[model samples]
Target chain A: MLTYEPDETVAHALDPRAKLAFQVAFAVAAISRPALAPLGVLSLLALGVLLSANLSPPRVLFGYRYPFGILCLSVLIAAVTIGPPWIDLADGVRTAHAAYGVGLVLLVSAAYVRSTPVRHSRAAIQSLVPGTPGRLLGIGVSLVFRFVPVLRRDIGTIRDAMAARLGTERSATERAVVLSSRGLTRAFVRADRLSVALQARCFAWNPTLPPLSFARADGLVLLLSVVLVTVPLW
Target chain B: MSTDHEYDSVALVPESIVRPFARAALLAALTGAVAFVSIPIPFSPAPLTLQVLFVFLAGLYLGPVWGSVSLLLYLTAGGAGAPIFAGGHAGIGHLFGKTGGFLWSYPIAAFVIGALVHGRTGFGFGSIDPTADETPSGGFFDSLEVRDPATVGLGRLVVALSVGTLIVYAIGAGYAMWLLSLSPVEAVAQFVAPFVIGEVLKMAATIALVRDGRYELS
Candidate 1:
């Protein structure tokens, strides 16, 4: 069963759209900077948001690790593969600085966004994207969110069946082949069904949409984003 | 040759056929549970999980409409802050970002697989509730009744599986291309190729199980 839930905190209260804009802006600004300073600032901001949300250290740390692993690996790959190599004792420093900076920004941005509520996030995205495509995108996002677990369960059932029928003694190669081919087929069939349902729901666009109400807090948050973003520019 | 005779005379009610929505949903929920078990890939951001196995089975077990609907429900729960995702990671942001394409393709992929399998006449008839007897001591292929060769043949099975596999790979590879910013060739090199062998084996097992009536929902 699904167990993630939004914490009742002020930081978690921002509209997902606003948070997304700010997070993207923060990440972009940090990325554009010459070095790691801006990224450090962004990380601090993420920490601040996490603290404000009153999320526990364990939960936040857990969230950080997987993405951090991806970020580190990517950075390592880039450092080895990308050019602009001017080496010395300080070479590691420069490479690490660039990699960590980009990695941290992306990770923090994802973390902040993930903590936000889905419906609100969708509404926010809908507001930002504009027109029919935007609405469709929202629906797409919604449907995907629902699909992951369902697919997970089916996989388990099939896996057990394979174990039973093919015997657990099947070679690794054989097991993998069976899993992937059958799994892919299932995914396609499920998609077809979902598409039909979505079509029936009359997912569409409204040109004259209702305006979003901006509270005093939204303004304050926007101002804060401006300040954070401008500091790098300054 | 008249085309009318080719079609089966079974009374088909679309609504009645579509009623397995809940079963599909249940299967999808189980899919999320499967994501918890991951095998590390030394060089990539993604880990190999037991997840895909269930995804295919969902299609086979639930058929197109219900299978996909089940996945949708799982995704909805996850996005709404349900911890039913890879490593129990869940939320709206996961739905919006880079890996979103792959995540979004789940239902589509499942439905395609399900529809393909459902098209095979032998695959469709195994709905006797296996859960009615929950003893794990039952032998492999216990509940299955091999279809009459004259009435339904394995040729259709091959055709259905081929089509279903194509759909799954199309979605997965397409998503990988977009997410990685690679050309089709490059994307397959990085994503699809590495996984192809494994996929093939999994499909065979899945096909066998479904053919043997292991997937018929209660």
Candidate 2:
């Protein structure tokens, strides 16, 4: 689940913390108290937020096709299985509303964070958490982004090694075994080697923390967030 | 928490003050990457992925504290907008979505798996071992620890993996029902039933690695 892709969108212009808060408020509003008009408004509002951030509505919907599709299928199944030879209207509405909520969440979240840098996320995290715990957390998140590509490559290598050793005719289960074993062993060994590298560099926690500077726009977003939260409660 | 002479990962790996934290960060990353290895099923929304393997492995290798610590880091990273969740999805949105229950349970599940691996505490019902001991069979913080997993009887590994899978499903499917407003049968159909065979296969694969003595990370 990697989303951050560099872009000069309006969402990207806001502080990472503000984006985080906006997404949180939006999700909370969606799940905590879901209703008809409010959900529709939230949906429109999410679309507006995405558009303002330079994301296309159709594109976001297309991106969410997988989950939305399954949600539709399940609702249909429920209607068919439990209904008396027909679709149940109430069940259908309820499921549709829930699916809407889910879709809104995925779209807004993907749009907001997809444009930001992994470093910005690290900075946002550091800002929320303070002192030693935050410091450690910031570093760990950095490592996750750093290694995702490395691990992806390692997985590819594992697949290649498996094909070479076990031949292509092996079952998916056999491939998974070798892939997991070899891939994880490589990851762990690399982790240990990282420790050695840390020792070699004499790394310390006092290394410069990622810089996070909140802006006036962020304050406005937070103020707007109050209304966002209140709407669901209202 | 204790930086003692025991095989605390921090002391032995890099020998430093903040190295444990570094290792924790690395483990979280590893878990995130493991999450990306998703295999979609034709029928169920929940896919067959190796996510649980790593989560349990995190517990097996990182011990209770660090294993839980790494999972916490993973949630934070994903929550803060990293695409660390399944299907490369990100943000706190997942924390409240259909899969929210599963995402929320990861840390607790990992901690349980790790604790059982260490025999530090009982998860529920029966303890990890019928006759409990202060220290577990071998190694501190193992991904099915090299020595112990390689040597331990198959029954014990099955018990450990079974307990871990059940914990994940209980919270995962429970929340899935509540969050998604599905009936009990529907919830089970979506979250548990489809994944049963795949989960078992993944578990068997992990155990096969253990039995084959391929456990490398000490």
Candidate 3:
């Protein structure tokens, strides 16, 4: 999985806010300029981002196989003509260019994902948006990150137990109902227990979060992001 | 442990908000976990996923406000790189990619489903008023109000889920068309048509799950 890993790479040292800005800027540049030349330059920058994060392009590509597959399929569908000329090469090329743009954007994000931790991301959000909304989002996001693995295990157990009993032979609706109901039941149970724990621990609205500061390198990254954001205008 | 610290200084999250928030977060996590559970359809390239089924349940169970909040948390967590998007793909990039439209529509769809199922009169837009009309079954915590989803009828659940499904497809197909520059017919054929069977199955599954009386949110 492409998640945060402890590393001393340059991308890892920068502020999460700077990285997030770069992602948004990169996405804007990729989406706005879909032509070959700009995309090629953006592709190199994206690859550079991956290399800086100590990530390989192929690993990221493998993680994105599903979206890539869909993009390829769309390209094929766009190329085939119903009648007359068998294939519209131009149409296929256009779709491919758009897909390539999306792929580049994905690559840039993969770098971000590999380099940044969830706590840093949460701190960035809490600081970016002030007051109650930010607090809710910051805490809620962490809660989700904590519980996804737990709930995933619960669902996996449900599936396994059902399989052991010959539940697969049941109709789709029955199996779905069985799985979902059981899944939901366990989730609520966990929620109830967790709520008690939070109350006991005095879950505060203003807890001390891990500090995030903009280092010297972050200034450079933000400047690069600003430059990327201006590409479409030029 | 630290009685010397000023107890009055800390502003604690109230029991009322804590319970629902925890439920919302868990439901969002459930939605993410289910994304990995893909069942293949014969001809279509994309397999059937139970993500939308949970979307419906989020609405039915959490109601309009918190249900939408749950989905919003899902989106944020996924964007922050939780490896929870379809097929374990995660990043801010997916939020702007071809399928971004469907992903962006989740909160709205949940809100719509919750409004329809709960039979709320107004648009309810972002309101977190759990005390509106539905009587809260006061638990041990005086502020905690638990509303049973079973109170809603089966027909309402079906209609609500159907409308939610339509919203997903409309936004998904429309966005895909604009992004990929596909004709309307082509977009529908490619994006919407293949998933009809899976969608129907999901709707049926959601309805069945909702009607089952064995489980209720505490």
Candidate 4:
């Protein structure tokens, strides 16, 4: 449920491209160097990112509870053995260390998600990858953003209608078929209308898009990303 | 009202591309929408979801190229913060997280399913009109025709979906094993064993949808 919110925070003002680069660098660094001291430093950087975006650590942690839980369970699984020594403490610790590194990477990504808008991300993608393929992806992504809610509503209505007709009594496969069949039909109908609308409005391969430019702060962010990527080398 | 004033500057997307592109985007959105509809299994820690069903249908409906394209769009949108990942988690992190293998396998699984079902590449839109045998014109729109999913034999459909399912599990478990430092046995125990029943059920549902023929691309 953590999504981009309109805010005047530092992370929000930075260029999405810079944030994306920083995230990739952070993940690489965290994964490549999973030692305790390096992980501790990365954790602090992740905290800085979360704070800059005005995201609460507890809230982000709660959002990712399921994956985190699985990570924790893996540690236990790593420890268990069937031999005389019954448990491998070193293996458990190693697994936990890797999981912690992954956790920090997730935290950095949560900040990016909280601060960057879909339009900004789309613009960044279009500018990052040039030509017709980029244009298709940019426009295609925007269309997806525009339609997920509408289709979600359609699915909801279908589910409700099925429930009203005592469709819950049916087998699981029967219910799934009914729901998906109705969902696909509605989606195809909507797509047909949407295609007509696009043609009517003269959907072009090259249209003027909202501009995005990297400011001075983004330069510093990019520098930080570069430094993070070089941490393993050092 | 000059007929030639800047009209040529606007390169409009042709109708042939527009229709499939719209359907692809919508299908991607539908994939996201259905992630919210999870059905909890009795003993398994992971719940069964319709995400895979949509992936299968994506291939069966859109053919290889567009089917993969649709899934690529879904992954990008989710990575950019759509609350569409399992349990509504989003961000680029999920793309590289422990379950990232499964997320990454989607497009490939869809592509495999589509290729096996359609029996040819090129989006399965290569003018399959049996009545008209004029070596169909080569333009984008002229050679295009939406093939009916029902036209595919049942055995092919089942085989395609089974292979798709195997690819998903293979990649998913392989990646998890590497990332989580689990033994292969542990990975299968954790990732693959629990979901067998749900996968079969989803395959059945997808097969039924194709057989029903109610949602033809045309």
Candidate 5:
């Protein structure tokens, strides 16, 4: 089970609404910039955000590498496919560099979310969808966290079962059959159980109830988000 | 934790009150699953998704209040860095990224749909006595019984869903135009035209499935 531990310094400090607003504003502003310099600055600020939250380099690296891979692919695609379709070295580098700038902005934004708690993230959403009941929102947050570990265990179980069934002499078709039948069934059964549990708990929407509050940290975050968006426009 | 203890807890609730919430959450997840049918859209960040169909279905199934709440829950999960987006990518930024308009409009779209279908004049599922062959049951009893499709037609339900879906498209198009800095006509040409055919097909399917009682069940 993945324990629900909120980081006091980072997660607890900011208002969920404020964090969401700031993130949205920053994402819009950062992605719109044509030049790499602004995004490069934002990438550095993502590092600063990690430092402020006291998150380790390894954690930051974990979220960033896939985006970097995407960035590489986007840049290569832009370089090879766009603008005159030439094999010229200079043109290739230029298009690739522009694509890299867009990718960098995307990477920084992902890092920000990774370092934040999932609960606060949900809170920001609550701010957007007016008349959302508090209990339903809370249950939704809980279910997302709850399901992750359940999914992880099911995957592990499937892998172990597959290994056991696939003896040294097993053919490829037999191995495929074992994986699809045993593994898929295990996953489906777990999902069905989860649905039944949720139903039993009376987890429907209660519209009259209000969502959780946004605190002082949320105000600061909102301010930062506004500044982030306006800075580019100015 | 034990099986006996879990069943004991489950046995306590009256089925009517408990059934709705369970049904709502399940429907929302199913709605998300339905939205995944659209693959590549050829152009535009917005894929031609079954999202509107399910959004309408959620409103119709959960009534006005819970239907909207389910949409909120789905958005919260997507915004919170779950890989549940089109082609499976997530983060708060995705809500503001190139395809931000569709993400932003979901809740409002759901609310409008729900509000349109927010009442029950009658009930379904064997509530009506099938063997009521007593010449319209005199006078007072006639008022209580369902009078077939003429009384509770599916057309009203389809109209309600369409209005809600239109609200989504309006918000989505408006946001896309502003974000992209395109003229109003240009935005419609680029963003709206591509998805029109698919959206119409989804609406027809949603109406057919909803009328057949494919909704409401877990």
Candidate 6:
């Protein structure tokens, strides 16, 4: 669900730091506004940003369906109450506002993650927060992003293998247990070897990580982030 | 081909700094990856998530410091927009939203679980040999036997898991109540009650894994 693309677009071109700043800006703007007006503005802005990033709207919206469904369900759940006052329709409206805020926030993050390479993101974190723990955390995060897709694929393979073995006849509990045991064991093995390999290379607390270079566009993106953040606070 | 050692994921290597960090990193990544394994129930807002299985295992395997450290890394990475959270959601915004309590309590729950499973002294890299702690003529304190982690053993693993689950529920339900502006009873009813069965199943899975993988769950 969270796949990255290798491309050269405006969204890809922006510094990861600026994109991170934009995410905070978008969150504030979306959360601070109570009315639907902000969502409309947000939707239009998200569209423009997506276009700049050269990402397809239909695919993005497709990815959103599941979360959108969950949001709708939450709105329904939040609306329910017993006895006097019956149902709180206003709560549903408020939840919807929050959902829109979350959606916009997600969109900004999606753009940044989809476009930026794991190495670039790592470099951004290392540069932003220098030192040993910061370097480890940044490298660790990059490692996770790199491995997520592989693990997701493993789940798919396990599900198919189970299905082939007539797993459909088994109870949900059985399936959960089998899948978890398999997945966790595999993860454990991979982690073990990875650590050995890292050790073989002589892991250093301050090993050289990728470098981050701020460009002219980064300045523009930073300025835009400042404007985006300031408008909501003001 | 080699026999995959159980608990190799958390075994303390001698004189190595980065091995533990790498292992913790992978475990943290595993936690994030599996968090999306959600099972829907007809009546509950909280779908059954596999997060606890990983979280509990981290503590039971790595002990408190590294286990807690790994979970915090997961949270930090997820907060930094890594899509390493449940439902593929990322960013700092979820820190205060609907799932706030459950999400916020993860590192602490992991810590508590580790503390219970691996006693405080056991948290050291390797098991402290009782004899090593004991001096030639007399012990550091001759009266007290050199009881180290080997004494803790696996008998109480289930109990530790149960306590950790409660910790998560207590904090989660409390936060959910506040966020929803509901009474304590209502919060328990709404947020905590529905997921009890799922949690039991998860605990059972962890127990089976621990028993099979290695005797030392800590």
Select the stronger candidate by DockQ from 3 and 5: 3
Tell me each candidate's RMSD, in Å, in order.
13.4, 7.2, 4.3, 4.7, 11.6, 8.5
**Candidate 5, overall lDDT?**
0.52
Which digits, one per residue and each the tens of the lDDT, describe model 1 over residues B138-193? 32223222232122346755565566556656776575344333346644554466
lDDT of 6 at B206: 72
lDDT of 5 by residue, B85-132 (tens): 554455665565435677677677766666555544222232122122
TM of each candidate vs. truth: 0.53, 0.84, 0.91, 0.92, 0.55, 0.76
> What lDDT tens digits, residue by residue, belong to model 1 across residues A1-234?
223356777756666656666665655555443445556666677676656666554565566576446434433433342335632324334434544544545444445544565556556657776653355345445544566556666667778898789535765534554554455457656755764664465322332232355667767777777776665565
The per-prediction i-RMS, to one decimal, reads 10.5, 6.0, 2.6, 4.0, 10.0, 6.6
Instruction: Judge candidate 6 against the unseen true structure and give its global Cα lDDT, from 0 to 1.
Output: 0.67
DockQ of 3: 0.54
Error of 6 at B83 (Å): 5.4
- Relative to the true structure, how large is the alpha-carbon lDDT of every model? 0.53, 0.69, 0.83, 0.84, 0.52, 0.67
Give the per-residue lDDT of model 2 (tens digit) for A1-234: 336667777788888888888887887787654778888889888888888777887776676666667677667655555546576767656666776787788788877766677778787777787755675677788787787668877877776776688545666567667767777777777777887787787554445445677789899889877777776667
The lDDT leader among the candidates is: 4
Q: State which candidate, 1 or 5, has the greater lDDT.
A: 1
TM-score of chain B of each: 0.63, 0.74, 0.82, 0.84, 0.68, 0.73
Interface quality of candidate 5 as DockQ: 0.10
Best candidate (score: DockQ): 3
Q: Where is model 6 chain A poorest over a 10-residue stretch in terms of lDDT?
A: A202-211
State the lDDT of candidate 6 residue by residue for B1-218, as single tens digits: 12343323322222233545666777777777776777654455566678888888777766677778788778767766567777777655555455657888888888888888777443443322222332223322122221223344566877888999998999987875554444565566656777887888788767766665443222
DockQ of each two-chain model = 0.08, 0.30, 0.54, 0.47, 0.10, 0.21
Model 1 C-alpha RMSD vs. true structure (Å) is 13.4
Off by over 4 Å in 6: A33-43, A149-178, A227-234, B1-15, B35-48, B76-84, B87-101, B122-159, B166-194, B212-218
DockQ ranking, high to low? 3, 4, 2, 6, 5, 1
Residue B159's lDDT in candidate 6: 80
Clash tally for model 4: 0
